[model samples]
Target: MLVTAFAANKTPPPSPTTTVNHPETRQIHLKPINRRRILTSLAATITPFFAPRLEVNYEESNLVTATFLPSADARGLFQMPPPRLSNRYFLVRAGESEYESMGIINTNPVAKTSMDNGLSKIGKIQTVKAALKLKEMGACDNNCWIWPSITQRAYQAAEIIAAINVVNRSNVVPEYSFLDARGLGAYEGRPLQSVSEIYASDVVSQNVKPPPISDGTPNESVADVFVRVTQLMSILETQYSEDTVIIVSPDSDNLTILQAGLVGLDLRRHSELYFEPGEVRYFDPSSIPKYKQPASALYKCLNPPSCT
Candidate 1:
């Protein structure tokens, strides 16, 4: 009964009959760089001029010289043991010049101790693996879902630029809309579909009887839904200069709620935007896990409790 009441009282869904018209183009202005000033300010052979100013401090260097010596049998006869061996031996030169003599030394237990404690090749590999895993996990923040769209657009633009490969262009034209959706129909003059209409018509129309009033509170208001749609549209526009057209059709009462919300957000006069409801996608927010804290926070709470 709740579902029926909500649906019946809801605003008429958006019209999906419309198709995308000619793509709109808006010019973004940018200030041209002053090449003359740049050339005048540029230094010719700047490195050469500053080369004398730079001083190399060879006197203060604390470089350590390591010399390898032949092991017993002198023909690679001994198997090199693991670094943990306290008395591990290696060949080294006894003195500084060509006059250096071959001598066996205990290798100063402290020196061997330092070399033993250094990261092993396996340890280095493990460190790299851990770093990569952390980076992958770090990308999944609250905005993770939005990244796919952003990345796709970026890749497409890159491809276009690479394909053209022209120089001295006055402006770079962007030729893709990232806000296109599958299914649903158009409202107003725009030719894109919305989620609400798709959900109501496809899902709600299936039941012969009206849905009962739900005991559970609605996850979001129609206006809230509209706002989210608009916000997503604005985000796309700001990021990629793409426009989003939303269409919703609701019953008179429910329409009032939607219109009020739209007016509150000052999007009522935007002709490119629409509100018709016959076709829209219905996303059930409840299906997704909603955590009080972000994924990072959750990780911190579990792994490094002190980080919080």
Candidate 2:
């Protein structure tokens, strides 16, 4: 029976013409998965070897740091000292062209004390001092024909004159004619009365130089001096017509006018108006005699001043 069963199982082998399909022989297909997830997993498996550990300190440490120190002359509460008359000279010169084009006249009206005081207070501050320093440093020369300091001062003076003129025309202030001391001349091609004559005729003093008083004296405060100067400037304004522009030559004369506080002027107003000394090819370095050359590298190393 066993031999017969074996022979029967063997007889089940298929002939060459007959074929049977097997499930294992059929083609198989796979479903797609997220490529990003696979790549992330692969990267995570290899990253630990390439990364480095970093250490940070939480406690404060004493570290010596070297810093450059500026020289003693370079360090001061005021970058530059208060402006003197010399500074205004350049300011007026720079504004001359504009004054001519605008037909600004040098009108000399008597200025009230309050008006003078208001303007003088603005001039004493450090900002004005810094402006004066810049003025001293810029320009082609002390006599810069193009953008002189006197031009800038004249510009400021013109504005004040314009304002006062408007006030007078509107009848806000009494219309009063002071003497014109400018002498008869053509200013910017216009025939005008002299500034000197204006000062001489209407006002008791025509170009009368104020008597020199001792400096640093208690008899009159600097503020009082400013008031007097402003008054003179106002008087000058009243004497000239709106068509005439006062041309103050050279920066020194302009500064003298400013020092007198006659124009309701401030240096800061003209700081950017004119070329500075450094900008100028030539300037009077003697104007600021205190400024000196920096010490040599070796000298500075040997003689450092105390900072504290």
Separate clash counts for every candidate: 41, 61
> Which candidate has the top score in lDDT?
2
lDDT of each: 0.25, 0.28
Which residue runs of candidate 2 sit more than 4 Å off their true CA positions?
1-90, 97-193, 199-254, 259-308
lDDT of 1 at 32: 38
Write one digit per residue (lDDT tens) for candidate 2, span 1-308.
Answer: 00111222244323222233436543222223557867897899866544443233435546543333333324322111223222222232222222223433321222111222122223223223423443445431222222211223322333343232332322212212111112112221232233333223212312233232233112222233234334434443444333222222222222332332322222212111233211112223244223222364311211111000
Task: State the displacement of the C-alpha of residue 126, model 1, in Å, after optimal TM-score superposition.
Answer: 61
Scored by TM-score, the top model is: 2
Q: Can you give the TM-score per candidate against the true fold? A: 0.15, 0.19
CA lDDT, candidate 2, residue 233: 41
Q: Where is the poorest 10-residue window by lDDT in model 1?
A: 91-100
